[model samples]
Target chain A: MYSYSDFDEAFVRSRVAQFTDQVARRLDGSLSEDEFRPLRLMNGLYLQLHAYMLRVAIPYGTLSPRQMRQLAFIADTWDKGYGHFTTRQNIQFNWPKLPDAPAILGALADVEMHAIQTSGNTVRNVTADHFAGATADEIDDPRPYAELLRQWSTDHPEFQFLPRKFKIAITGSPVTAP
Target chain B: MTKAHDIGLRMVRNAGGEPGFEVIVGGGLGRTPMIGTTVRDFLPVADLLPYVEAVLSVYNTLGRRDNKYKARIKITVHETGKAEISRMIEDRFAELRPLFGGGDQAVLADIRTAFAPPAFRDAPVAAHDAFYRADPVFRSWADTNLAAHRNAQYAIVTISLKAHGQTPGDATSDQMRIIADLAERYGHSDLRISHEQNVILPHVHKSDLPVLHAALVKAGLGTANVGLLSDIIACPGMDYCALATARSIPVAQELATHFEALKLEHDIGPLKIKISGCINACGHHHVGHIGILGLDRAGVENYQITLGGDGTETAVIGEKTGPGFAYDEIVPAIERILRAYLALRTDPGETFLQAYRRVGLGPFKTALYGEIGQKDAA
Candidate 1:
């Protein structure tokens, strides 16, 4: 599991504070849903049919036990005691309040995780073969390349308006483009 | 996604399951998606990055980005035509190919180790029957979902996400942690996501089935319906998908519910039902034995069915079966088709795809919607 550097830590905390402010305004009705939709989505918050669904990005589906425990905590506190891991390697809580998402994001930031770019037609969590690190049939660890892509695609201006949500699944060098 | 073998190159399969050092390129997903025509079969390791650049340059220039629906590697290959793309790739390949031309030896020079499958003990077949022994629940699930691995002592495992009436591919945070631990303990700490949106422990020792099953059961990943009718592939639809005209997740749930109610999933023997929010086909509707693509009719969600599609080593895009059905009528429509497959299939050995190929879609369509025509041609 990769630990967050100092820079990664600050970046996440900043993003959390930013989202926390946004959530406060939205809950206070100072900000409209129309304006907040993308913001919330970027933060992996969704107003689903039954309740709010908060999707937490796992960043290429990699997680340490500590991070996993934090997720369990979120599921217990803000959700229905469970979370859904989506096809994109992200987790979704079927229940959460509109006002609680920022706190969830804040918790995720503490774990060096965030929901940024998990949604909204941007280069999604740079998916890779789940067998990247330990697969008997891979080149180098695909995570580094996936990480490279994460940096490259983060708030990537050029790909902002891709025709569709572009999902790039890199693999062990060139051997398996899983 | 590039596959080295498809490009006319060849290499020895490693003692482990992987092929010798090389690269494959040009695969993508979506409506016009392709499995990517393999550009180079087996090239040396060093040529990887440069060759990838060549392929991307071609795709970047030629791939259709205009039509949101058609902008995928498959569409590009289809429109540009494989022959031309091969030539362009070959031409570009010559200059860039050498970078990776150095082969497996180069990998030794680097810190990364070569990839290979482990040696298996090739144990005498355990009365696999012992696995099923008598627990009908586990029996049915293991029969439907478990896949045999090449290693006599190992099996490829699919952890199904379908829970009947629930979102198909959704995994809870707890589920993730449990599965991760399972991978670390039972599997090789390696997991792969199947195109069907299921998680796969690609290498599970056969002896560990019971222990693995118990852990998975606790985690809710032990549904044991890997290739069965209940194991469906569906895209997030109108609920969250902005590109969707109709909802797919709900429709998938309804069908799964219906199938569960009937208790026909495992007994149905290897049937795949893929549903997509729209023709963008994220759920891989094109590959389902009974494919359902959601349609919006008068602001209401309807579904169009397709037959004979498969996603595998032998892949075929599905064909439409006449008109679409309203939301209420869709599940029953699926039931009608499944019945047709059941009544028509030769035996349990004949899967839905095989049966479809043998008898074709006409009989099934006629059984559901009345005969406009009848022919066995797939």
Candidate 2:
């Protein structure tokens, strides 16, 4: 699994802080629903049917045991007891409170995880075959490149405001590559 | 290769040893489902980036901006046709090719070196066989969850997230931890999340199967229903998704529970029942053997069934059955179709898809609407 460097950690921390301020502003009536909607979406927060849903990106669907444990903690402590893993290999906390979004982002930042780019029109999470490194028939692991792409696309200026969401999926195995 | 248009690009490897890709374009799924057309049948591996850049540029210029629904590359491809799209991509590629030169190959080489596969150890098969014989449940799970690995001693284990009566792709925090632990200890620290919403331990020694299965069982993740009806793929429908017109999870849960109670899934053979909350096809309902699309008809939730959709190498979009069913009528409707399949199939060897293909929709439709038709006639 890829671990966050000092730069990566600092980037996420700063973003989390920014989001925390934005969230506070929204609560304080400084930002309306329309203004806060895109901001919150870029942070992977959605005001769904019943409650706020927080989608956390699991890049290339790879997770360390420690990271998985942290997610479990987040699920147990903040949201419901379980999380819904989406088709994109991301996990969604269906019942998150509006106020807890910052806290959840902070918890994720501790584990080198974030909800950034999980939603929005920008290049979303770079997905790879869940069997990337482990599969026998694959030409290569594909995750390293997926990670590279993730870093390159995270906040790429040129693609930040594309008309639609861009999804990139990579797979080494010909049999499983969709 | 066919559905490339939907996602903008598809790379099919060239047959020769020299690494290359045959890029397909314009495949996508949604209200206007389309399979991608082959734009470049034999693009060299080195030209991947510049070529892709060309395609995206073409799409950026030509793709629809007026209607949000029609903005995908597929629609552009549909309007312009494959010939013009190909010509535009080739022209762009020609212009951009010189900028790349040969730098991308070195980068690719470095990436390949970093992605080398892990060393695997041979394990005795006797241990696995012994465990399989000792525990019937383990045997059942092994039969379904395990896939043949390149190494004789290794097996690819699919830890199903779709347990009976549960959300199709949901895992409890405890289950996730157990899977992580198993991947670390038994699976050479390798874990994968399958596109089908299952956790995969891609390199587990056969000798470690027993302990892994036991651990999974303890964590409530031991569902031996891979490829079975219970192993459904359902998107978060009305419960969570704003675009959804109907609920998918409850329907899946009910069907899974009903099948489990009957204990008929394993006997029924391989069946893929994918449920999408709407036409967005996030659940891949279009490619499921039995595809269920939830729609809003008036104020009520209506479920539409599509039969014979296959998402394999030979992908086929499922054809819709007649009218949609109400929320409560869906399970019984599914039951009727399954029963019809069971009765109409040539033998047990014939899967749901094979049976459906052979018998067509005639018998199944009759099974579903026969009572209603009779009542109306009376």
Candidate 3:
């Protein structure tokens, strides 16, 4: 439900443009595999087992209908015809190619989404109870806080180079007896 | 169920009736599973960002950087002890709190407005009632897949991605569009992806149930196994992940297909079968009712089973059964455990988890290895 502001849009589009150049450099051999690895990871591209995998963040597990449709389009047009949703509330395109990474990110930016910090050593996607706003047992929706954390953690200079990936989760509901 | 994250925050009300959090820290699964420790009894909602920052800063500085496996905040908490870590976090929080300058609070206020609840329709529930009465199939699907919404006239629908024998969490592009369409048409355009790897239409009016059910049935997304055995949570494992030791997808597929063929999942009731390809525990195998961890035993794929693990608010790490089964042997091992459960449970009302908790692991262990070992010896 949260639409991206101009600042958010500009930030994502710039990241897309920067990654596009980084990808081109890698392909042209100006950037070696070692040099390109961290650059690609910062943008949520990973060299998976069979092919390159791109993890797209679904912040707090929330998606707009338009965003969902765009993800469907990406799945059909780019990699394989499907995407795998992980336990961390993100989606993975398993067979994306190196050349298509930039375009994939660009498509994501159009929907006000990105793969930034999805796979990095820095703070990853902030997750919350999927039934945050709708469930009967909720104290308050935690997604706003999760979104705030997402904003704070994304490219935060101090946490950009943590020892390993960090995960944060919030729940608005206390456990209820079945 | 936020118990298995590096930082897990549960919304709570303090004595003054102000919204705050029960802040938990250092919880994770992987090879060494740990339930988080409550670092703060109740932290004010306004101080959340600063407190969290303090925790992370403490961990980032003191957390082991030398060993990748031991670098998590859980390991840090284990080595540093809870009291010391708590003291350091409090000290850091004292410093960080002033620096925030209410900037995070200002941003949070703006973010909160974006999460306004969808306009719910107060429609008659005649269609849903009639369908439930007339169609047993719809009734079954509705019973399993639907959760109670805050608005009584609405329901939260979890569309099963784990249709029998298919890849558990993989949704085809068409499936995505179908869900997207349903969300737009009937669910107020809000969609959620559950940690259990299912798509959720969080606010579907009861009047729209029949039409939504019809669409899902036509799309093959209408499997009525939400918390059932076939609704497995499996990691990518060796099939897609570079870190996996053995294939997880095939094992999950086999188990789902196997139980579906037996036609006993509904009867068995509420069993979580989570599989991880390696000790990394990405599948959250440590907290499953039946946890299967796949490993490379002398270059051969071997599967180890852990019993009675729970991932609920009362989280508990699972206990391993003796020895590992080979890839071909894993499915039958699961079959043995379930069959034994069927014979041993007091009544059908007893779910797999309740039964396991009641009888403990003795019966299931006997079923899995004892008879097979005797037969092999003979």
- Candidate 2 CAPRI-style tier: acceptable
TM-score of chain B taken alone, every candidate: 0.81, 0.94, 0.96
Q: Pick the candidate with the highest DockQ.
A: 3
Candidate order by TM-score, highest to lowest?
3, 2, 1
Tens-digit lDDT string for candidate 3 (A41-149): 9999999888999999999899988999999999999977999998888999999999999999999998999999987678999988888888898888889999888
lDDT (Cα, tens digit) per residue for candidate 3, span B1-378: 567788999889988888898988988999889999999989999999999999989988998889998988999998999999999999999999999999999999999899898777877998778878999999999888999888999989999999998999999999999999999999899999999999999999998998899999999999999999999999999988999999999999999998999998999888999999999999999999999999998899999999999887888899888788999999999999999999999999998888988998888878987967634523
Compared with the true structure, what per-residue lDDT tens digits does model 1 show for residues B1-378?
A: 222111111133444555433333344445554554655455443444455446555655666667855754556666787689877877777876665455423433332222234344455436555766856767756665566554557767778888777788776767867877887776765565544567777677777777788788877777866667777878777876667888888888888888888988876877778888887776778767888889778888878898987654355668788788888898888888888888888887788788889887678879778754334322
lDDT of 2 by residue, B243-342 (tens): 8988999999999999999999998989999999898988888888999999998889999999998775566788877788999999999999999888
Cα lDDT computed for each candidate against the true fold: 0.67, 0.80, 0.90
For model 2, the stretches where C-alpha displacement exceeds 4 angstroms are A5-7, B1-5, B8-13, B100-114, B371-378
> Considering TM-score, which of the candidate structures 1 and 3 is the better prediction for this target?
3
Q: Give the candidate number with the greatest lDDT.
A: 3
Prediction 3 TM-score vs. true: 0.97
